[model samples]
Target: MSISFAFLLKHIRPFGTSGYDTFCSVDLANFLIGNLGLTLGDIRVLYTAWRGVALSDAQSAAIIDCAKDVANARWGQLQQTTGSTVMFLSGIQLQDLSNASLGQSFTWRPASKIAVAVRIDGGHGGHHARWDVEGFSGNTDSQGAICHFSDLV
Candidate 1:
């Protein structure tokens, strides 16, 4: 039960497919603000970035995509502290869900993580150097793991 574009679209009263042409990012953001309480400017930025690049429907879809990404990222962060029961739309490792025809299902539980350290030094001299260290605490090797998938259909 993940939040989807269609689900979000249902929230706005008069925002069916036909509304795309007349409504810009600002209008969409305003629509979402009442439900998600997101910063209008932030969503406007995302909408403006893709504005005029495609047809009206595509632009509207892009804004929805942006909102979905933001929500998913936050959900992922929450999973770090408290594990979540996530549904795999495709597949993970030993299990294959991609080819499920209709009333088929597969369950996959995969976990892994890796630590990393990075250093950058200026070519001119050692005077300018930067170091990045991650996964320094609490099961660093299992900190983050993503389910790999692809749409072959």
Candidate 2:
């Protein structure tokens, strides 16, 4: 059987931490399924290649990008088959609370939107976190953040 989106997201690691362009595992998974025409089994192989191996960030990005490029060459567009609603929230950077724990809670008002995949970047501060419409969690070097939300409607 084919794997589900949620399943892929949970399996992949953080894209930025994994040497991707500030993208998390979920985003890459979306790209693979949404942008690239990759099945879950196909993706699992990629993950297996680097699960325990140590490679530079550039090398990792190269591998993933190569796969992405191949998919693009084969498929014209990676359209969502499920017709899910995607909303990207830019300029919604917020600061973390003082004396907060790792994965602290913070809030950002959205334009009446929900999310399926969320990514937060504490730009310049090198602090990255995960967020939703309601709240978020993670440590920050500064009080700045960038958020992207994909609603799985």
Candidate 3:
């Protein structure tokens, strides 16, 4: 009933599949929230930070451990870095996805470094310390809310 390394290896398209190399945080959030019982607030916050970070399925038990850690810590898990699986999630209009190498430990946790006065919120209006802020919606406390800081933002 588990997604084993062997299963992952078997499914990993002769390194063939185009965009199936990793999992997105959005999906992860849905799964964790809907199925795994991870705290919605925890997942939502972590999801907001990375959103689309490429989580390499290449790690041994990286995905599994991620779920466990999220359940245990329930807070302060944003910059997780287990093996090639860096905790930065990103994908189309989201974070942009960053896949891991192969067989690594996953990690997660964080505290927002955004200076409210300086950074934009909910696409309302304002500039981040660096990137343009856009696309993000809902109030800061909304579970669906996300901040996009990019050149195009």
The prediction achieving the highest lDDT against the true structure is: 2
* Candidate 1 deviant stretches above 4 angstroms: 1-6, 9-27, 50-153
Model 1: lowest-lDDT 10 consecutive positions: 132-141
- Please identify model 3 stretches exceeding 4 Å from their true place: 1-26, 51-153
On residues 96-126, what C-alpha lDDT tens digit does candidate 3 reach at each position? 2122111222221112211111222223222
Looking at candidate 3, what is the lDDT of residue 97?
16
TM-score, structure 1 vs. true: 0.25
Question: If ranked by TM-score, best first, what sequence of candidates would result?
Answer: 1, 2, 3
Q: Per-residue lDDT for 1-153 in model 2, tens only?
A: 122333233222222222222222555666877666888887777655434221323234443433333333323344322122212222121111112233212343334332222222212212112224443322222333222213222
Off by over 4 Å in 2: 1-24, 55-153
- Arrange candidates by lDDT, highest first: which order? 2, 1, 3
> After TM-score superposition, what is the CA distance of residue 127 in candidate 1 from its true location, in Å?
44
The lowest-lDDT stretch of 10 consecutive residues in candidate 3 is: 7-16
lDDT of each: 0.28, 0.32, 0.27
